[model samples]
Target: MRRLRPEPLTPEAFAPFGTVIEADPASAIGINAGFTTRFHALAEVEVEGGAPILSIFRGRPRPLVIDMLERHPSGTQAFVPLGGRPWLAVCAQAPGAPLRAFLARGDQGAQYARGAWHFPLLTLAAQDFLVVDRAAPERNVELADLAEPAQVALDG
Candidate 1:
């Protein structure tokens, strides 16, 4: 097994794989008497020919181990945390390419581009998330098993 430590999530570092959705009052359009701020169009959502589906996912914390990776070739997938808890994201350029790990806070979210290989949701604590993706009739997942699993580590 290989050990890997995740780096802090930033818009620049995550740009290659997808967009980093963050709330910035400076970049937001104020509405409702300036009481609320909205960061609009934070991600490039692609659904191909399928319809977009909104779903909620509750994930339990688990050890960071990448035994396999999966990808969606038909559409882009986004995950936003509903609860204020930090999480981890692992992604790669392709099925067998080198992997990169990112640490995201509760307020941050990510949208992965089509065909980008990634691991499933990972959290240090249990958390709920809003997931948006394409709903297609055919299978859209492409999975690959790694010969050597990658163990994820986090630093303060």
Candidate 2:
């Protein structure tokens, strides 16, 4: 098995795949009588053939071995942690492309670009995530088997 170490997630490192959703002071706006700071437009929701829908995904801890990856060809997918638990986002530019893993903090979220290959959610602990994606009758997921399994190394 191939071993892959996840790097800490940042906007610059993750820009190739998609946007990193988090509260940015540069994009902050004081609203609601200056009591609430709204981090507006952190990520864009792109849909090709369907409307976007909101859903909650409860993820459980799993082994860090990656055997396959999936992608949404018709829309972007966003995962925002509701439980404030760190998680992993594994992605590649295309099928058979070199893979990259990111270790995202609890306060951070990820929005995978349309047609971007990514492994399913890898939660460090049991947690809930607010998901935004397309809702359509047609199947939107495409799966590809990796040439070899990659084991994610969490320890430095």
Which model scores highest in TM-score?
2
Give per-residue CA lDDT, model 1, range 57-123, as digits (tens): 9989987889899989999999999898889889988766788999999899998888888998888
Give the per-residue lDDT digits (tens) of candidate 2, residues 1-156: 889999989999999988899999999999999999999999999998899999999999999999999999999999999999999999999877888999999999999999989999999999999999999989999999988889999889
Best candidate according to lDDT:
2
Candidate 1: regions farther than 4 A off: none
**What C-alpha lDDT values do all the predictions have?**
0.87, 0.95
